[model samples]
Target chain A: MFLFFLSSGMFLGWSLGANDASNVFGTAVGSRMLRFRTAAILCCVFVILGSVISGAGATHTLGKLGAVNAVAGAFVVAFSAAMSVYLMTLARYPVSTSQAIVGAIIGWNLFSGSPTDSNALSKIIITWIVCPILSGIIAVISYKVVSVFILKRKIHMFRLDEMTRYGLVLMGAFGAFALGANNIANVVGVFLPVSPFGYIELFGDFCVSPAQQLFFLGSLAISVGVITYSKRVMDTVGSGIFKLSPVMALVAVWAHSVVLFLFASQRLEQLLLDLGLPTLPLVPVSSSQAIVGAVVGMGLLKGRHNIRWRTVGGIAGSWVTTPIFACLISFICLFILQNVFQQTVYLP
Target chain B: MAFISIFKNRTGIESEIDSFLNLASESGLIFMQGIDAYLLNNLDSFSEHLSHIVETEKEADTLRRSIEDLLYRKTLIPESRGDVLELIERMDALLGRFKGVMFRIEIERPNINSQFHTGLKSLSNCVIEAVESATLSLRSYFKDISQASDHIHKVAFWETEADKASTSLQKAIFNNNELGLDLKMQLRDLVRSIDKIADHAEDLADTLAIYVIKRSL
Candidate 1:
């Protein structure tokens, strides 16, 4: 019964990998600089490593947003988020796992008659709008710095190409790692409330906790999605950020990584707080938003001609609607699962 | 659908640019043949080769336009798209010069003294060599960029030889009593025109060199 409830979490994880992972390496693969197979392999390795190592921090913030203690409640929440992602994908919108997970949490709260923490909810919402804007600002600065340093250096064309290729691979690895660290909360956050497996000693000294087991399984599902479905998404990603020079693409990815790491890294947050500096909120920010922001920043810096405003309008519209759609869907699904299906959704 | 098409999966745009280079090279071959027949006073063969050169130029033009369209329409390799476009346009201009020189030679049909035949033929060979070298350098830019400079230097060398050959031919035309003063000037213009073909080729080769450097560093 416990294993059965994990299905929805895995499904959500797969969807996150399928969509978000595409944005992670889309420019490199779509440009034919890096092959799809190579990008996918790198994504899988770094994303999994990121999930297992740095995944714990963001889950606490998600838990504070809403704790659906019942396994059945968690299942419905994951399912609702997955449905939202799928719907967004079909419409060709930039799907955000952070939006989906947060929406699902709100739905769980409303359905279980638990009070939603207004302060936590506000922080998440603010980050959603700020994340992309921050990404754009960082991208503009990075592009300017790199353009002055590398592009204007008058280096030989062949040498510039080799260097850009290497830079893309390095930024790609870092982006994948940042993505796994920040966004794994969208996969295994709900499952933390009612993890099925306790500590199991595989070797004499090696043991794993219930949360680790769930996260590892969730990470595997994300990997499967990257291996199977992310290719199509990656191709589309190339066209979204047009007129990007090699250095510009690298700057965009680097900006995105910085935004994600700032939000997701608990050690950084702790260091800030200890140094008498304000700590950034350890929230699971949207990778899609960050990357889009970076692209927009670069585009805007170049000129208005660089961006297709019609496309930008459409993507922005989708971002506004996704959370609302996901919240309503999850609420409706939880009500039906608890009342109509006679399943326990919330626990005392 | 348009958006999806823009993101359509494809391999290196360098290969597409290569196909255009190949077409340009074919027309270069046609240009060389037309001049060879022109020098031999074989009107029939010259006409045949000239017509073929014209046809190849038209085809090359069409290919170049199509490549430009594809580059603008698709978002593949946004980084290098501009460089590739510039390269093709330069090569396309060289093809036009090829056709122009051939057309001028056919219309004028200057009666050359056999004594100057060796100089003219040697000059024509040098021009062809420059064009060939330019095409080779561009090819190597795609396949093996490290080898690109070696081919580019050859283009420069042949261009220099062509300059010397044309200038020597001009001096000889003036010294000979067999040709009238007015005829000598006309023949001199023809020699200069032939040298321009090589000049155009060298210009393209120089552009390719800059592009190679831009991509590498």
Candidate 2:
């Protein structure tokens, strides 16, 4: 029964992997700088490592937004979010798994008569708005610096091509790890409170917590999605949306990885606090949004006419609609799971 | 280990491209020597220069094929591969034209009057300079795109000089009443043939300018 309930979260994980892995490796693969197999293998290994090592920070934030204490309720929340994402994808609008999962958790809080922590809700919302803007700024600066360096160096064209290939591979690895660390919460955060797994003792004093184990499972599902289903999406995003040269592609991936790392790295947060500086809130921000922001930043740097405003407007519209759809689906589904199936959805 | 191999291959390919361009320039020099020897009635030197150019063209063709193979096999420069390949092939065709004109002179062995020798030599010199400028522009395109425009404009300059030399030589041939119409026409054809090499070089220079612009970061 626990496995049955965890399947929904795994499905959500799979969906996230299928869609978001493209943000990291799409341009590399699409531009033929890196093969799809090479990218998928690196992405899978690094994503799992990231989820198990640093996934707790974002999950903690999601837990604050709403703690669904029942395993069945967690299943319903994940399922609703996945359904909304699927529907949105079918409608051909850009969707963010982070947004859908957040809205679904709030729906569970409302259904269970648990007050959603307004502070956590506000922080998460604000982070969503700030994530893309920060990514764009980083991308613009990085692109300018790299362009100037290449020009000043007067590197041979073939040498530059080889260097860009290696850069894409390295940045793709970082982007995959950051994606796992940041977005794993959207896959299994709701299940943390009602986890059925036990902690594992490693070496003499080392231990793997239950949350880590749950995250490992979710990340494995994501890895499977990457290996099996991400190639087509990577190809599409790499070539269709924005025609990026390999250098621009590297900049976009670098900016996306750095933004995800900033939002998800607990060590960075602690270091900022120790330095008496304000820390960014740890949250699951959309990889797709970060990539899009980076691409747009590069386009803007080149010229305003380079951007397709209609595509940007359509993506922004989906951001508003995805969460609302997930919320409604979660509320109705939770009602059926509770009364119709005769299950207790909340301790209260 | 893989990265080291890429580095080694990159250096090898870079030098190979340099050698190929050098061969193109070398062939132009040999073509000018062959034309000068023919006008001076030095059959032995003319034949020697012709064989040297023929060998140079063969060497360039072989080098070009190897470079194209390496580029495609290794998948380097995915974005600019087509442009680079086109540039190399067009330059090779230009070298072939040099060889073709040399062969024409070898076969026709036109009896050139001493009075026309200076005009023919001057025209050949101008055409070779235009080709040399085109080669320099191509080299700059690979090493420093900023310097490419500097060499590209010079190709046009040399091409105009060649046009002036060819026009004056044709006028000299047509004005000489001692020469038959057939001989005048033959000499005019030779002059135009040499002039056309410069025209081809100018066209390549224009294409390279566009490629340099495309290559800018």
Candidate 3:
């Protein structure tokens, strides 16, 4: 029964992998700088590694927002978020799983009569707005530094192409790792409170925790999605959206990875705290938003005229509409599950 | 291991490109020598230089095709591959032009008066210098794009010098009442054909300038 209820989260994981993997490796593959097979294999390997090792940070923050204590409730929340993403995508609006999942969790909170943690909610909201801006700033600075460095070095043309190809592959790996660490929460965070897995003892001193087991399972679904469905998304995002040079593509991906890492890295947070500095809230930020932010930043650096305000406005509008759509869908679905099917969706 | 292969492939292609450009430059020198031998009435030496230029041009064409094949096969330098291939083809065409002039000189075997020998030699020198500058610009384009402009500008300067030389030589031919009109026309045609090589070089330089701008980071 627990496995049955967990299928929705796995489905959500598949969707996230299908969409977000493109964000990491699309430009490299699209520009013919790297092969699709190479990109996908590296993405799958590092995503699972990141999930097993570092996925907890953002999931903890998401659990704080609203911990749906029932497995059935978690299932409904995941399903609702997935539905909202599908609907928003069909509507030709930009959709983010992070925003949709957060809104669905809030709906679960309202239905269950649990108090929403205003602090966590506010932190997630603020990060949504800050994520893109921060990524854009990083991209501009990195591109300027890299371009100037290349100019000064005067590397031969073929040699420079070779170096850029290597750089793209390396950065794509990092971005995949970061994506898995940061966004695994959006895929399976709701199930954390009700995970059925128990800690398994490996060696006398080594053990795999229940959370790591759950994350590993979730990441496997993501890996399957990358293998089966990510190629088309990667191709379109890489070449069809806007043409990016291999170098600019590298900078954009690196910037996006860095921002995701900033939000998801507990070690970084602890390091900041140790230094008596403020830390960024560990949250699942949108990978698509980060990439868009990086591209926009490069456009701004090139010139203001290079940016298309109409497209920016459309994407911004979807950010607001997506959450609202998910929230309403969650409320309606939970009510039906409680009243018509006579299933318990809330502890109360 | 992949890293080692990448470096190896790059080094091989780099040396290939350098060798190809050297062949183009060598043909220019051989063209000048061919003209000098023809003026000095050394038919055997002229034939020797002509054979050497034909071999150089053939070698350049083969090298260029190999580079183009390797570039596509490896899918190296995707962004600038088209531009690079176009540049190689144009340079090769310039080399063939040098060979063509040598063949024309050999086939016509124009009767040259001693009066026009110095003028023809001067015109050949100017044409060779123009081609040399064009080849150097292409070399700079591959090695260091910033240095490309340094040599690109010189192609036009040499081309202008060649134009002046060709004009003065043509004037000298037409003014000589001792020569028949048919001979004068033949000499003028030869001067113009030589001058056309410099014109082609200048056009190539213009194309390189645009490619450089496109390649600018």
Model no. 1, DockQ: 0.11
Clashing pairs in 3: none
Please write out the lDDT profile of model 2 over residues A254-341, one tens digit for every residue.
Answer: 8988988898788999999999999999876777778878877877887877676776676678778888988889999999988999
Docking class of 1: incorrect
Cα lDDT of model 2 by residue, B56-103, tens digit: 999999999999998898888877888999999989999999999999
lDDT of model 1 at residue A336?
92
Write one digit per residue (lDDT tens) for candidate 3, span A1-348: 778878888987887777778788987987888888888899999999989888887543346677777767888888887777666544434457888888888888888888899887888889889998999999999998988888788788888888888888788888888778877776776677678789899879789988889989989988987888777667645654456678888888889889988987889999999999999988777887788788778878877775666766766787897778778888999999889988888886
Question: Alpha carbon lDDT of residue B100, candidate 2?
Answer: 93
Best by TM-score: 2
lDDT agreement with native, every candidate? 0.78, 0.85, 0.84
Candidate 2 off by > 4 Å: A53-61, A87-94, A189-214, A264-282
TM-score per candidate: 0.69, 0.91, 0.90
| Candidate 2 TM-score, true structure as reference | 0.91
Better of 1 and 2 by lDDT: 2
Ranking by lDDT: 2, 3, 1
CA lDDT, candidate 3, residue A52: 85
